[model samples]
Target: MSLAARTLELLRDEGVDRVFGNPGTTELPLLRELATTTDPSYVLALQEFSAVSAADGYARGTGRPAFVSVHAVPGVSNALIGMNNARRSRTPLVITAGQQDQRFLRDAPMLGGDLVGLAAPACLTAEEVHTGADLLPLLRRAFARVRRQPSGPAFLSIPMNLLAADEDVPVPSRIPAPDAGPSPAVEEAAAVLRSAERPAILAGDRVGATRSVAELTALAEALGATVYPQPQYEYVNADSEHPLTAPSPHFTGTEIAKALAGHDVLLVAGAAIRPHVWTPERPIPDGVRVVQLDDDPAEIGRSYDVEVGLAGSVGATLAALTALLPGREADRERGARIAETLLRERTTWRDRARAGVDAGGPLDPASAAQAVADAVAPGTVVVEEAPTTGPALRRALVQRDAGDYHNSSGNGGLGWGAGAAVGLALAHPDRPVVGFLGDGSAMFGVQGLWTAARLGAPVTYVVVDNGGYRAVSDALPPGFEGTRLGGVDWAGLARSLGLHGTAVEHGSEIGPTLAAAQRSGEPSLVVVRIRGGAS
Candidate 1:
């Protein structure tokens, strides 16, 4: 069989049903083979960045590794930004780039460069298949590395001549991921939690990735502990409305220290102990014990000092800890007090949002977000990258499901949401997928709209057109300049890209526009023009 045929067979055996890519001359051999194969459908993007971002979202939505193919050096370089985003998000991806024919190596042909070197930094593993015989082995290794615990993107460079050559290569069987059993440190961590007067659980995106929300919730309730998400990677660890579940505190060190002031024990589960994007120089409260749990040993106590660091599966460790700890009834009083505080905070935020809605003139972000949240059907998936309006949207929408929300702020990467929505919509075809993007972010990967339209993806792209990079503007010191982004008609651009486009200037139009777009059963964009100033 040809190497391309064997590659497809191996991918199919590994449960890859689709391949996302933007093809070039070197990829023609693989593309020809893919056209004849029916199992793994080819989903094309106009650009390599969109291709990688789409795969990233698909992996996140499905809890499975995704495959992507691209042209050689330039293509891999173009996709590096998305690859970095995937690395930060810990999304598993198998990225393959087609290299120039091996025979032209001495000449260093056009479009021929060092593909492996370009992709290595952005991936967990990067290698090249030097011969047809090496292709299957390299692919097997790539798949294994990408699916390991603390999984990330892997890259493989396949020469075009090798892919086209006939070879009697044996199809490699898929390798199962290794699991780490419970360790003694788990018991020590449980002991710390049980003995502390006030314990708190800090969950992260890994909790959702591991499907360990139920176990984490059980452990938290067992200790009568308050649950907070890592500030940058907030999602539903417990039910969002649960009394013990609190919104993630601010990212600053001072704010986090304040929130954790009284907690005697901090059980950091399925997350790094201290992964801060930007933090003030404030120490955590003295005498506060930190116990960390993670599947990756490298991340245990990586950022902050820890009393107990356990390396094992998050779900299994939480289950064991819950079994060892006392029931929620044991600390009912402490739990009640924590619950009351969280309830008051939530109430205050909601009241403030209601006032904003009632006093609206030009559409405020909070009001616009609330309208969309109210209009979308239950179980709708939101892919958000609206940095300036994130807090407002989080307060207004208040997503409760563990899988209903995905944000691109993990790596602070713009332009991810547009393409991610395309892949997420494909992953969950039955549910509506909304891409809430800032106007500045929308411009970064606007080409993805063409792919959405081509695939007829069910996405309602809401471009929050604030006329500038509001997040950057808001962060700058008093009178800094050069952030203004004026005179771009996002709705018109969407229309030109073959999507249904609507321009909305008032909060009243947000709901109707979103509803109509969803009902249209095709790719659509709503350009929401807000009061244009620094956030």
Candidate 2:
């Protein structure tokens, strides 16, 4: 078998079923080989960045590494944006590129500059295989590294000579190694949790993945505690309005201190206790008991100190806690109070966010979000990265089912939105995937829009443009009066990338625009210009 063909088979044996990519001349050899391989299917994208980003999303959703094939130097450069996104998000992805023939070592071939250099700073590991014999080991190491705790993207460069060479290398069937870890600390933490009067638990992306909610709910109820899901962790399916969910009154130093100070014991399950969270405006209470749980050792108490730190599978930890605590009457009573409070607060917050929107200016971001909400059928997936307007978007969205929310939780990167939308659409093509990205973030890895257009994907891009980097506006930079840094011709930008784009300037225009896109069943976009400034 050809080296390239056998390598693709090895990847497929590793449970990587898809390669999302964009082809270039340097990558042509691997592309042709990938095309012939039966195990892993190849999906084409219009840009290298989108290809990498899509692979990131596919990996995040499926809990398996995805492959991306790009050209040697230029393709690696373009894919760097996504490589960074995947690294930040801790998504397991293996990006492969075709290098110039090995014979061009002394003299620089057109696309043969240092490939490892381009992918190094952006990904977890970047390696260039010198011979066909090195492919299996390098590939194995890349897979192992990317799947390790604090998992991330990795890269490898395949020279043309190796791709075409006849090498007798042992290609073993890939069996994914188990990543299970000890959870003894979880039991000890539960012991601490049982006796506390006022306890709180925070859920993150990991919790949303497995048994986070049920276990946390049990523990919170038992302790008569409050629960908080960090938006930074991508909504833990714990709504801001849920009684079980605590208020993040402010992210500022003063505000966070006031918010977290009341709890006597705080358990961070699958969520990070960022320094800003515990000691925001004020130093956290000196003796508050803190327990941190995560599968990755590197992430344990990173931003905040933990009295007890547990490293193991998140679900395993939660399950162990459930067994130890069993159940408690005080927990149930406190849980009831939390539910009642959550209902009241959720309604109030939703009303407050919606109040100004259904009334003011040329268009309201809330009502505009609401329009998209109405236009979307249930079961559709939403990949949200609209940080500033996150509260409004969450309030607007009606779907609360598990996995309906696509999280870029660990890394709040901008380029993740557009390309991630492409990946979700590819993974679940039957469902309509909407990307709620702000304009500033849109520019980060927007080449995905071109990919969507080329695929005629059923995903829609609903850009909330308040002009400039709205996230950077803490209330005007130095000179500007309002929030806008500048104007972005959203529709013009989309059209330039080959997507069917439209401009929606008023609240009334949202419904029609969304309806048309849904009806067309094409990759379309609606750029809604709304007044900037926090709601």
Model 2 misses residue 320 by how many Å?
1.4
The all-Cα superposition gives candidate 1 an RMSD in Å to the true structure of 1.9
lDDT of 2 by residue, 210-310 (tens): 43566666556556678766535553445443457665443444655566676888777776444323432443456778888888777886766688898
TM-score of each: 0.95, 0.89
Evaluate residue 355 in candidate 1 and report its C-alpha lDDT on the 0 to 100 scale.
Answer: 58
In candidate 1, what are the lDDT values of residues 1-535, reduced to their tens digit? 8889988999988889989999899988889999997789999999999999899889887878999999988899889989988887788999999999999977999989899999999889999889899999889988988888778899999989999998899997888878667756777887788888889888877787777888888887888899987765634555677778887766667777887888899988876434344556443567889998888888886777889998888888899998998785658778888889988987787666555654455567777677777778778898888777766777667566778888866576678888999988988988999988888888988888999999999999998877777767877864555787868988889999999989976677777779889888889999877765453
Off by over 4 Å in 2: 35-39, 179-182, 235-242, 247-255, 273-285, 364-367, 398-402, 409-412, 475-487, 492-498, 533-535
Question: How well does candidate 1 score on lDDT at residue 376?
Answer: 80
Per-candidate clashes come to 0, 7
Alpha carbon lDDT at 356, candidate 1: 60
State residue 176's C-alpha deviation in candidate 2, in Å: 2.7
TM-score of 1: 0.95
As a TM-score, model 2 comes out at 0.89
